[model samples]
Target: MSIYVGNLSYQVTDEDLKQAFAEYGKVKSVQLPTDRETGRPRGFAFVEMETEEQETAAIEALDGAEWMGRDLKVNKAKPREERSPRGSWGGGGRSGGGRGDRRY
Candidate 1:
Protein backbone atom coordinates (compact mmCIF):
# COMPACT_ATOMS: atom_id res chain seq x y z
CA MET A 1 0.00 0.00 0.00
CA SER A 2 1.02 3.57 -0.57
CA ILE A 3 0.73 6.73 1.48
CA TYR A 4 0.27 10.18 0.06
CA VAL A 5 2.32 12.85 1.79
CA GLY A 6 1.25 16.39 1.04
CA ASN A 7 1.91 19.95 2.18
CA LEU A 8 5.56 19.07 2.06
CA SER A 9 8.34 21.54 1.90
CA TYR A 10 9.89 21.53 -1.54
CA GLN A 11 13.28 20.93 0.08
CA VAL A 12 12.25 17.57 1.51
CA THR A 13 14.36 14.84 0.01
CA ASP A 14 13.93 11.12 -0.50
CA GLU A 15 16.11 10.26 2.46
CA ASP A 16 14.31 12.74 4.69
CA LEU A 17 10.94 11.20 3.90
CA LYS A 18 12.21 7.68 4.36
CA GLN A 19 13.71 8.49 7.70
CA ALA A 20 10.57 10.17 8.96
CA PHE A 21 8.54 7.03 8.30
CA ALA A 22 11.27 4.64 9.41
CA GLU A 23 10.09 4.79 13.00
CA TYR A 24 6.92 2.98 11.97
CA GLY A 25 8.37 0.42 9.56
CA LYS A 26 10.48 -0.25 6.51
CA VAL A 27 10.01 2.09 3.61
CA LYS A 28 9.90 0.24 0.35
CA SER A 29 10.12 3.24 -1.94
CA VAL A 30 9.36 6.90 -2.42
CA GLN A 31 8.17 8.61 -5.56
CA LEU A 32 8.55 12.40 -5.46
CA PRO A 33 7.33 13.90 -8.67
CA THR A 34 8.66 17.08 -10.22
CA ASP A 35 7.18 19.71 -12.43
CA ARG A 36 7.71 18.95 -16.11
CA GLU A 37 8.46 22.46 -17.17
CA THR A 38 10.51 23.75 -14.26
CA GLY A 39 11.86 20.50 -12.83
CA ARG A 40 10.98 21.33 -9.22
CA PRO A 41 9.42 19.25 -6.48
CA ARG A 42 5.60 19.17 -6.73
CA GLY A 43 5.10 19.61 -2.96
CA PHE A 44 3.98 16.05 -2.43
CA ALA A 45 5.15 12.44 -2.68
CA PHE A 46 3.90 8.87 -2.64
CA VAL A 47 5.57 6.48 -0.25
CA GLU A 48 5.34 2.73 -0.20
CA MET A 49 6.01 0.71 2.91
CA GLU A 50 6.91 -2.94 3.31
CA THR A 51 3.43 -3.86 4.53
CA GLU A 52 -0.07 -2.47 4.78
CA GLU A 53 0.09 -2.43 8.57
CA GLN A 54 3.23 -0.36 8.40
CA GLU A 55 1.58 2.01 5.98
CA THR A 56 -1.39 2.41 8.28
CA ALA A 57 0.81 3.06 11.26
CA ALA A 58 2.70 5.68 9.39
CA ILE A 59 -0.49 7.30 8.27
CA GLU A 60 -1.85 7.51 11.77
CA ALA A 61 1.34 8.91 13.15
CA LEU A 62 2.06 11.40 10.45
CA ASP A 63 -1.29 12.70 9.37
CA GLY A 64 -1.61 16.32 10.50
CA ALA A 65 1.81 16.11 12.11
CA GLU A 66 4.12 19.01 11.57
CA TRP A 67 7.41 18.52 9.80
CA MET A 68 9.88 20.74 8.07
CA GLY A 69 7.87 23.80 9.02
CA ARG A 70 4.60 22.54 7.56
CA ASP A 71 1.68 20.46 8.76
CA LEU A 72 1.92 17.15 6.92
CA LYS A 73 -1.10 15.69 5.17
CA VAL A 74 -0.73 11.95 5.13
CA ASN A 75 -3.18 9.27 4.07
CA LYS A 76 -3.73 6.25 1.88
CA ALA A 77 -2.95 7.08 -1.69
CA LYS A 78 -5.90 6.76 -4.03
CA PRO A 79 -5.61 4.46 -7.01
CA ARG A 80 -4.52 6.25 -10.14
CA GLU A 81 -7.22 6.89 -12.69
CA GLU A 82 -6.69 5.79 -16.27
CA ARG A 83 -6.59 8.54 -18.84
CA SER A 84 -7.36 8.54 -22.54
CA PRO A 85 -4.26 8.46 -24.64
CA ARG A 86 -2.83 11.80 -25.73
CA GLY A 87 -4.54 13.47 -28.71
CA SER A 88 -7.15 10.68 -28.98
CA TRP A 89 -9.88 12.27 -26.77
CA GLY A 90 -11.72 8.90 -26.34
CA GLY A 91 -15.18 8.13 -27.86
CA GLY A 92 -18.81 9.32 -28.01
CA GLY A 93 -19.32 13.04 -27.54
CA ARG A 94 -19.82 14.43 -31.03
CA SER A 95 -23.33 15.64 -31.83
CA GLY A 96 -23.68 14.70 -35.51
CA GLY A 97 -22.03 14.14 -38.84
CA GLY A 98 -22.53 16.07 -42.10
CA ARG A 99 -24.01 14.45 -45.26
CA GLY A 100 -20.49 13.91 -46.55
CA ASP A 101 -19.76 11.72 -43.49
CA ARG A 102 -22.51 9.16 -44.23
CA ARG A 103 -21.04 5.66 -44.37
CA TYR A 104 -23.52 4.38 -46.94
Candidate 2:
Protein backbone atom coordinates (compact mmCIF):
# COMPACT_ATOMS: atom_id res chain seq x y z
CA MET A 1 0.00 0.00 0.00
CA SER A 2 1.33 3.39 -1.01
CA ILE A 3 0.94 6.49 1.11
CA TYR A 4 1.66 10.14 0.47
CA VAL A 5 3.18 12.24 3.21
CA GLY A 6 3.69 15.96 2.86
CA ASN A 7 4.59 19.05 4.87
CA LEU A 8 7.67 17.27 6.07
CA SER A 9 10.53 19.08 7.71
CA TYR A 10 13.54 19.41 5.47
CA GLN A 11 15.67 17.71 8.11
CA VAL A 12 13.59 14.52 8.27
CA THR A 13 15.39 11.44 7.05
CA ASP A 14 14.18 8.16 5.55
CA GLU A 15 14.88 6.31 8.79
CA ASP A 16 12.84 8.85 10.75
CA LEU A 17 9.90 8.21 8.46
CA LYS A 18 10.29 4.46 8.72
CA GLN A 19 10.41 4.58 12.50
CA ALA A 20 7.29 6.74 12.58
CA PHE A 21 5.18 4.25 10.64
CA ALA A 22 6.82 1.07 11.84
CA GLU A 23 4.72 1.29 14.99
CA TYR A 24 1.73 0.02 13.02
CA GLY A 25 3.23 -2.48 10.55
CA LYS A 26 6.06 -3.30 8.23
CA VAL A 27 7.11 -0.64 5.79
CA LYS A 28 8.23 -1.66 2.34
CA SER A 29 9.97 1.55 1.37
CA VAL A 30 10.23 5.26 2.11
CA GLN A 31 11.06 7.71 -0.62
CA LEU A 32 11.78 11.33 0.14
CA PRO A 33 12.17 13.38 -3.00
CA THR A 34 15.17 15.69 -2.82
CA ASP A 35 16.58 18.50 -4.85
CA ARG A 36 18.63 17.05 -7.66
CA GLU A 37 21.29 19.73 -7.25
CA THR A 38 21.33 20.51 -3.53
CA GLY A 39 20.18 17.10 -2.17
CA ARG A 40 17.77 18.75 0.22
CA PRO A 41 14.49 17.11 1.10
CA ARG A 42 11.49 18.42 -0.86
CA GLY A 43 9.15 18.47 2.12
CA PHE A 44 7.24 15.45 0.92
CA ALA A 45 7.67 11.70 0.52
CA PHE A 46 6.07 8.39 -0.45
CA VAL A 47 5.80 5.52 2.01
CA GLU A 48 4.88 2.02 0.90
CA MET A 49 3.59 -0.46 3.44
CA GLU A 50 3.06 -4.20 3.11
CA THR A 51 -0.75 -4.10 3.20
CA GLU A 52 -3.77 -1.87 2.83
CA GLU A 53 -4.61 -2.29 6.49
CA GLN A 54 -1.23 -0.92 7.47
CA GLU A 55 -1.55 1.87 4.96
CA THR A 56 -4.95 2.85 6.27
CA ALA A 57 -3.74 2.69 9.80
CA ALA A 58 -0.78 4.89 8.98
CA ILE A 59 -2.94 7.44 7.25
CA GLU A 60 -5.40 7.55 10.11
CA ALA A 61 -2.77 7.75 12.79
CA LEU A 62 -0.37 10.12 11.15
CA ASP A 63 -2.50 12.22 8.85
CA GLY A 64 -2.49 15.13 11.24
CA ALA A 65 0.18 14.03 13.66
CA GLU A 66 2.91 16.47 14.47
CA TRP A 67 6.38 15.60 13.29
CA MET A 68 9.35 17.83 13.86
CA GLY A 69 6.85 20.48 14.87
CA ARG A 70 4.84 20.25 11.65
CA ASP A 71 1.58 18.40 11.14
CA LEU A 72 2.09 15.78 8.44
CA LYS A 73 -0.21 15.38 5.48
CA VAL A 74 -0.81 11.69 4.86
CA ASN A 75 -2.99 10.04 2.25
CA LYS A 76 -3.02 7.40 -0.44
CA ALA A 77 -0.59 8.28 -3.17
CA LYS A 78 -2.12 9.23 -6.52
CA PRO A 79 -0.89 7.60 -9.69
CA ARG A 80 2.00 9.53 -11.17
CA GLU A 81 1.53 11.09 -14.55
CA GLU A 82 3.32 9.55 -17.52
CA ARG A 83 6.34 11.39 -18.86
CA SER A 84 7.48 11.72 -22.44
CA PRO A 85 10.77 10.26 -23.48
CA ARG A 86 13.86 12.29 -22.69
CA GLY A 87 14.75 14.93 -25.32
CA SER A 88 11.35 14.41 -26.91
CA TRP A 89 10.10 17.89 -26.28
CA GLY A 90 6.59 18.45 -27.67
CA GLY A 91 7.73 21.58 -29.56
CA GLY A 92 8.78 19.80 -32.75
CA GLY A 93 12.13 18.33 -31.65
CA ARG A 94 13.66 21.50 -30.29
CA SER A 95 16.42 20.83 -27.76
CA GLY A 96 16.29 22.31 -24.27
CA GLY A 97 19.19 24.74 -24.58
CA GLY A 98 18.26 26.54 -27.77
CA ARG A 99 17.17 26.22 -31.42
CA GLY A 100 20.21 25.87 -33.67
CA ASP A 101 19.08 28.22 -36.45
CA ARG A 102 17.72 31.04 -34.31
CA ARG A 103 20.13 33.93 -33.73
CA TYR A 104 20.26 34.84 -30.06
Candidate 3:
Protein backbone atom coordinates (compact mmCIF):
# COMPACT_ATOMS: atom_id res chain seq x y z
CA MET A 1 0.00 0.00 0.00
CA SER A 2 1.01 3.57 -0.64
CA ILE A 3 0.58 6.78 1.34
CA TYR A 4 -0.98 9.96 0.02
CA VAL A 5 0.75 13.21 0.90
CA GLY A 6 -1.12 16.39 0.13
CA ASN A 7 -0.64 20.15 0.51
CA LEU A 8 3.02 19.85 -0.43
CA SER A 9 5.00 22.73 -1.75
CA TYR A 10 5.58 22.88 -5.47
CA GLN A 11 9.29 22.90 -4.83
CA VAL A 12 9.33 19.59 -2.96
CA THR A 13 11.16 16.89 -4.87
CA ASP A 14 10.91 13.12 -4.82
CA GLU A 15 14.11 12.86 -2.82
CA ASP A 16 12.80 15.24 -0.21
CA LEU A 17 9.74 13.12 0.32
CA LYS A 18 11.80 9.94 0.55
CA GLN A 19 14.12 11.47 3.08
CA ALA A 20 11.35 12.73 5.31
CA PHE A 21 9.66 9.35 5.45
CA ALA A 22 12.95 7.52 5.81
CA GLU A 23 13.20 8.60 9.42
CA TYR A 24 10.46 6.13 10.31
CA GLY A 25 11.70 3.24 8.17
CA LYS A 26 12.75 2.14 4.74
CA VAL A 27 11.12 4.09 1.95
CA LYS A 28 10.32 2.01 -1.10
CA SER A 29 9.31 4.67 -3.57
CA VAL A 30 8.07 8.22 -3.95
CA GLN A 31 5.99 9.67 -6.73
CA LEU A 32 5.10 13.26 -7.38
CA PRO A 33 2.55 13.84 -10.10
CA THR A 34 2.82 16.68 -12.57
CA ASP A 35 0.38 18.84 -14.51
CA ARG A 36 -0.05 17.37 -17.98
CA GLU A 37 -0.34 20.70 -19.74
CA THR A 38 2.29 22.74 -17.91
CA GLY A 39 4.47 19.93 -16.55
CA ARG A 40 4.53 21.49 -13.10
CA PRO A 41 4.37 19.69 -9.76
CA ARG A 42 0.79 19.07 -8.54
CA GLY A 43 1.64 19.80 -4.89
CA PHE A 44 0.92 16.23 -3.81
CA ALA A 45 2.67 12.87 -3.81
CA PHE A 46 2.56 9.15 -3.00
CA VAL A 47 5.02 7.31 -0.85
CA GLU A 48 5.46 3.62 -0.38
CA MET A 49 7.22 2.16 2.62
CA GLU A 50 8.57 -1.29 3.36
CA THR A 51 6.14 -2.12 6.17
CA GLU A 52 2.78 -1.10 7.56
CA GLU A 53 4.35 -0.12 10.86
CA GLN A 54 6.65 2.30 9.07
CA GLU A 55 3.75 3.70 7.10
CA THR A 56 1.68 4.20 10.22
CA ALA A 57 4.56 5.85 11.99
CA ALA A 58 5.20 8.24 9.14
CA ILE A 59 1.54 9.09 8.86
CA GLU A 60 1.20 9.76 12.55
CA ALA A 61 4.30 11.87 12.78
CA LEU A 62 3.89 13.87 9.60
CA ASP A 63 0.16 14.20 9.12
CA GLY A 64 -0.07 17.64 10.66
CA ALA A 65 3.61 18.56 10.64
CA GLU A 66 4.89 21.58 8.80
CA TRP A 67 7.37 20.90 6.04
CA MET A 68 8.66 22.99 3.20
CA GLY A 69 6.48 25.89 4.35
CA ARG A 70 3.21 23.94 4.17
CA ASP A 71 1.21 21.75 6.57
CA LEU A 72 1.26 18.16 5.34
CA LYS A 73 -1.80 15.99 4.82
CA VAL A 74 -0.63 12.40 4.90
CA ASN A 75 -2.73 9.27 4.75
CA LYS A 76 -3.16 6.01 2.96
CA ALA A 77 -3.81 6.44 -0.72
CA LYS A 78 -7.07 5.21 -2.20
CA PRO A 79 -7.14 3.03 -5.25
CA ARG A 80 -7.33 4.96 -8.47
CA GLU A 81 -10.71 5.01 -10.18
CA GLU A 82 -11.11 3.88 -13.74
CA ARG A 83 -11.98 6.55 -16.31
CA SER A 84 -13.50 6.31 -19.77
CA PRO A 85 -11.57 7.35 -22.84
CA ARG A 86 -11.94 10.96 -23.98
CA GLY A 87 -13.42 11.73 -27.40
CA SER A 88 -11.55 13.28 -30.35
CA TRP A 89 -12.86 16.71 -29.43
CA GLY A 90 -11.45 16.39 -25.93
CA GLY A 91 -14.72 15.15 -24.34
CA GLY A 92 -15.90 18.56 -23.29
CA GLY A 93 -19.29 18.57 -25.05
CA ARG A 94 -21.38 17.02 -27.85
CA SER A 95 -19.15 15.55 -30.52
CA GLY A 96 -21.29 15.24 -33.65
CA GLY A 97 -23.44 17.78 -35.52
CA GLY A 98 -22.46 21.40 -36.18
CA ARG A 99 -24.39 24.67 -35.64
CA GLY A 100 -26.67 23.61 -38.57
CA ASP A 101 -26.64 27.14 -40.11
CA ARG A 102 -24.57 27.67 -43.26
CA ARG A 103 -24.62 30.62 -45.70
CA TYR A 104 -25.01 29.60 -49.34
Model 2 spans with C-alpha error above 4 angstroms: 85-89, 92-104
Between candidates 1 and 2, name the one with more favorable TM-score: 1
* lDDT per residue as tens, model 3, 1-104: 99999999999899999889999999999999999999889999999999999999999999999999999999999999988677644655755637774447
> What are the models' TM-scores?
0.82, 0.80, 0.82
Q: Which pairs clash inside model 2?
A: none
lDDT for each residue of candidate 2 in 46-87, tens digit (9 for 90 to 100): 999999999999999999999899999999999999988899
- Cα RMSD (angstroms) for every candidate in the order listed: 3.3, 5.1, 4.0
Clashes of 2: 0
